[model samples]
Target: MSTSPTTLIAVPDSLDTGTPPAPAGRRWQPQATHWAALSIAGLLLSWWALTASGLIAPLFLPPPQAVLARFGELLAGSYMDATLPQHLLASLQRMLLALLAAVVVGIPLGIVIGVFPLARHLLDPVIEFYRPLPPLAYLPLIVIWFGIGEASKVLLIFLAILAPVLIATAHGVASVSPLRQQAALSLGASRWQLLRHVILPGALPEIITGVRIGLGAGWSTLVAAELIAATRGLGFMIQSAAQFLVTDVVVLGIIVIALVAFALELGLRRLQQRLTPWHGQPH
Candidate 1:
């Protein structure tokens, strides 16, 4: 009587048990582009509102429209004996040249200092001392040495850029994983091979970061450098415009500088991601 044989049930692995599946990795999230656009739009609206309401004088902060009109005029004609394109190109050339020189000299020097304690000890003091000094603080000496020419402007920018790159490179090289070095050496890799394969790649992200920082510094210093007897540049254009009370041109110049710096930084960041895609990735 007691019991019919108890029935045994087996569950299949593929059978749905009514629970939802866990999300595949992480879900894709919203991007920052929309927010950036919104912020920019908001700023423009605020600027327009302020100027339209007569709360802010156009002399100090021109409406965006006025700056836009001035920008077009400059593009179509000339300012300070050079067109907008020429001024923009001149500034770009100086920044690029300075960046190139900084990269060429700084990366190698930083690597040396990072690799050799003796070298680091010898140069660290000098670098640290000069790194904290502002560009304007030493511009006079640079001008005296290089004179009021392209050399001075380029050199001023170069010096402004050098410290960040050098520090970043040295830090990157020094921060390389010792385990990677050991593994490479165990595989009969020479010092150069180890550096080429393991160290440089590992250090690339930091180096790129340094370059980005250096570019920003150099860009900010552009106006100051160009102020040193520059006849044609965005800095000079802005300065000259300000002297003549052409607030529209000054505002336009400032906006142009910001846009250009943003573009350069965006490009460099892309390059960094391309070169070091594995950066910050989990093992």
Candidate 2:
């Protein structure tokens, strides 16, 4: 075939087949903190709007200014026979004590359950049976046996925290790879060495997760726990305020509790990132 003249077509180096890249200045992505702040701001604005528009009664939902004023009052003086700091301290002490106890007992029990079938058979049923029950359901029983003292209060929170830790530890331990365990054993590692070097490191993430869950449980149970004749606690303050319909004080107490819990959660998340940087990474 004799071509009179072959025509060559030139093509551009790049084609405009897809959307163009965004400019650096306009490409900003909202970080988790930004989203969180925005969400909080939105909620606060909604609250203010609702209150300012008089859509809700002040007794039901006090204005932000009233809550803030109540907070200042609490800081300057006492409410329900104790200052705000005193109530916070009392709550923190109980929470810390219960958390310490849960960590001490739950981790070892979980290890035993994970490593030994006999232990699992013996304890798993008991843990599963009670883990789902609300703290309030057992509060009266705890009071009856332990008395309506600090002991009962602490025990109530402790029980609420224990289950999650125990379950998480057991699950983490079980999830440790068999191959890794075998390799450790093949290197003439003792049981203790195998667990410390191979198992614990592998299981640390789950253990931390469990503790986080347990902390949430403990907080949820705090109000119920404080019901056991607590003279001082954020929960006690909330309860006392509710009884007298002190809406501002009640809101203030709730805000304080939520803020404290959020702070603790942030602390735990930092700890988790420090301890297990590889936890959520791809293999």
**What are the lDDT scores of the predictions, listed in order?**
0.90, 0.90
Q: Any idea what lDDT model 1 has?
A: 0.90
Model 2 pairs whose backbones collide? none
Candidate 2 lDDT tens digits, 1-283: 2222223422232235555444334546678999989999999999999999998999999999999988888886999899899999999999999999999999999888888889999999999899999889988899899998898999999999999999999999988989999998999999999989999899999999999999999999999999999999999999999999999989988889889988998899999999999999974
Model 2 misplaced regions, further than 4 Å: 1-27
Give the clashing pairs for model 1. none
Worst 10 residues of 2 by lDDT: 2-11
TM-score per model over all chains: 0.89, 0.90
Per residue, candidate 1 scores C-alpha lDDT tens digits across 121-229 of: 9999999898888889999998888899998999989988999999999999999999989999999999999889988888899999999999999998999899899
Q: Clash number for every model? A: 0, 0
Residue-level lDDT for 113 in candidate 1: 86
